[model samples]
Target: MTAPPTAPATSNAVGRRVSWQTGVSILVMVCAVYLARRHWPVIESGAARLAVADRGWLLVATAATAATWVCSALAQQGAVARPLPARRLVAVQFAASAANHLLPAGLGAGAVNLRFLTRCGLPVGRSATALAVKATAGTVVRGFLIAVLALACPGVIHPPHVPAVAVAVAVAVVGVGVVLLKGPLRRALRAVLADVRAVHELPARAAALWGGSLAFASLHAAVVIAVTQALDLPLPPAQVALAYLAASSAAVLLPTPGGLGALDAALALALTLAGAPGSAAASAVLGYRLLTVWLPLLPGLLALGVLIRRRVV
Candidate 1:
């Protein structure tokens, strides 16, 4: 007779170990948030006034942000052949959003999504493919819009350090475009599309994906504007566009969780370069993050609990 399997002594060790990378990412975010604000009094007073002065505007903006999330859920629907309940998909999306705010490199968001997708009966490969398509679509739409806005707005066009950055970005974009359009690249694209039978079948799925992407990009921009106003930075929409665009680009490219430290630092620096005082820029970055990244985590935790109980992952 075969012996029964024995439990390893160190099975618990894996569960007990702290993630040093996560810890370090958190530490860096903390230091950046704390250190960047030298004139605390100014930042505090400005933030307080803006909060009171523009409460209505902020509310409207927040609603727009929520709508973007709904759009994101719709994008997920695009990739999956079988439809899960919309309400459940939304909860999963919200939970993912919450996690994104809490974790560095956007891992929290990704993990929550993976869990939800798997729970909904999608195989690993399909889930990954779905995620990949959604991500690429979102990136292309957001980046294209931002780039156009940056070029069109004089305020954005004239920002400090922007010229050099723009040239570099232009070169990179051209190079990427060339690569994507070439013969081998075209073949690769054809090969990829060959396997996505489900993705190809649904009518209006493309529209929904694009719509969600556009809405999310707009909401992301609005949040930045709201936070800046809250800090009484007085930055015009143009400058906000450029700063938001550049900072967000850097954050997304960075490998760290949700681009925690990298995002804040880049935004602060970009804002400062755009003529805002350092403290004000820092305050805007910090306050904006509080709403966008941290506060939503509470809802995420609750959603996570519900998900676990439902056995839907």
Candidate 2:
């Protein structure tokens, strides 16, 4: 008998899939190159600032930056019920952070983690749910910290005055959107709530989820604070922390990769409003970016390449 008719169809399908993946990889590389070109000046400035920053305080910021990756790994683990290989989990988080910087609104990081979870034997639906749980926890913890810090350091961040009519229109728009998307929204909410309940039933998982998220946010703020201290930005630690939280939270509204440009502008402005001189605020922002983004970026990307080569993610 001749070859089965289905063999040709299977080969064609495999060829199409490979082509699609290759196209996507090329597009991602193009976007990354464009972003790097656009942000080169800022990166150079940040590096210059880091060179002159107080070594002691810079060391503190560096340490905090390293810890944030560990916190991310812990939170991710807490999202799923099954145990993940500890070393590989942390390495993936590092890789994810580099990916986050390359794609908008956390898409790269999410994709990386989703692949990792599926590789580790989780069903696709469950892996997605776990990601949602971790993201929800992170958002809640960040907002809680902002609110607490705002109250503790009154006047650190002044609320912008909004026209009543403008506020009403915004609320109305959100209400209409919610009504339109209620079905999908409801389903997603239910799924996330179910996962949350299941994860919380285990004390270790619950603690890791909440504690790791809290620590992750706190450590990031600490990095900014340390940078400010290093450069003598004349801002109190609490105020710097509040500025970081508020700026970063607001920056989420703009879906640029890793909050790159958007976060830089918002953070500098927040610092200025909090009484730091413009130059000093700019330096502190640059310094923060240097330690958090530029420094670890290459190593993270290398780790990502290695993981891919090993078919680990």
Candidate 3:
């Protein structure tokens, strides 16, 4: 009699599991369809623009794109107290790039990295702090590069005339107010500050953190330059780099999956404003996206799957 009752319970548990799995599958399918429909125009335009770009320059852009993974690994290593496995770390960065596109505002990448770091034996809190540190370093380096380039080519980068600065200040003030009001956020901030201090105490890690951050931003800008050159865009390389840094940095405020629409629009607009023909600007933007986002996407996804199967991420 007891065996018969247990069998029904087991069957009910299995049924519930299967139902949950089916629901999740349907949700994923819905999301996929939605994203595809929404991004179709950008996809079509990028394809058209890339069809005419010089293939050789595209290869250089692709190469620069590959180097970004190494830079990211180095930066991540600098963020934590313990050293991460170098080979696995680089692979995780590559995989994270693909994951980054699947979710809005970098949640996918952060989740992947958090998993990887925890698997490497760090506690969850420290892993999150490491992410925060790397992000902070990357933002600072991008801003520094933009400033330097703007000074180098003042004629290309016009002064800011809009009330954007005031708006940004107001936003910062509001953010600070919120942070102060939120207890959990306050604790998180304190932990991040502690980790920042710990990481800065190690000279080698400090250098790697800042150097890798700078290199990552520079390589990204180099990718843009290669794309522009491939299209024979007449804009100067410095101007292109400056525009890329500024546009991409600004695009961070509006997080769309890998900055798909936002970055593309900003890049094309910045390039045109920098004196490139509209067609050339579009071509360059398309080529850059092709190398950085589209081309590697499949491989990155495959790598993500492999890492999951191997239980590496």
Candidate 4:
């Protein structure tokens, strides 16, 4: 009698859980459709531009976009001493990119990678630490690239002049924010530093971490540059690269999913500042987004779903 009651109870719990998952999936699909409809005009315009783009240059952009996933996989592998399955790692990065765009900032990608690491035998805490280390390396490499490119293309990205009072206020605000978050920040910093040290102890890991990060950022810039070339945007390659790096860095501040609006606006503005016409700048930005985001999105999501069903991530 007890067994019969327990069986129905277990079935009910499982049914409820499945129903909840179905509801969430439906909600996500609805939101995605709504967003697509809202941005239909922009999507149409980008598609028009891409339709006439130089095939050779567009091919280059596509290749670079694909290589980015491989680079990302390399960086993730570098985040820990243990060897991960290379093929699965690359596929997970592709899926993670789609996941990343679905959530604000990088929460989705981080969660996916965390799950992957845990599934690969890493402890939860260690998995989180590895993510932090990979993120830190990427950040450092991006900033370095920006600084170098800015110097190379002198005057390409002019910093906005701020009033002394505004600068002082910004500094004060940052100081206060730091003070308030000091405890948690300090603990996090310690963990990241510890992981950084451990990862650096292996020369191969260090090289993969830093080198992969460099390649990832550079390839993204290359994609933008290739788009500009394909469209005959009348900007030097170096200037375009500089504009992309600077705009992408600024986009980081907004924390939008996939840096959607923020990156689009910033890249357009940067390209315009770099001497491309408004229409050309817009086309370049759209083309870049098309290749990087829209094209890969469906396939990446499919991969994510497959990984989930297989319990791979």
Which candidate comes out best when scored by TM-score? 4
Worst 10 residues of 4 by lDDT: 23-32
The CA-based lDDT of model 3 is what?
Answer: 0.84
TM-score of the candidate numbered 3?
0.83
Query: Could you tell me the lDDT of residue 85 within candidate 1?
Result: 78
lDDT per residue (tens digit) for residues 20-71 in model 1: 4345435534533443354355445545644654676667556766776787
Instruction: List the candidates' TM-scores in order.
Output: 0.70, 0.89, 0.83, 0.90
By the TM-score metric, which is better: model 1 or model 3?
Answer: 3
Residue 150, model 2, lDDT: 86
- Spell out the clash pairs found in candidate 1: 104-257, 104-258, 105-256, 105-257, 105-258, 106-257, 106-258
Model 4, span 272-306: residue lDDT tens: 98899998899999999988887777667777766
Model 2 clash pairs?
none
For 24-143, candidate 2 gives per-residue lDDT tens digits of 555545655665677788788888877888999999999999999999999999999889999999999998998899889999899999999999999998999999999999999988
Model 3, position 26, has a per-residue lDDT of 54
Candidate 1: misplaced stretches above 4 Å?
Answer: 1-53, 101-103, 154-192, 195-201
Q: What ranking emerges by lDDT with the best candidate at the front? A: 2, 4, 3, 1
lDDT of each: 0.69, 0.89, 0.84, 0.88
How many backbone collisions does model 1 have?
Answer: 7
Error of 2 at 76 (Å): 0.7
Q: Which stretches of candidate 3 lie over 4 Å from their true place?
A: 1-52, 159-176, 179-182
Query: In order, what is each prediction's RMSD in angstroms?
Result: 7.1, 2.8, 4.2, 2.6
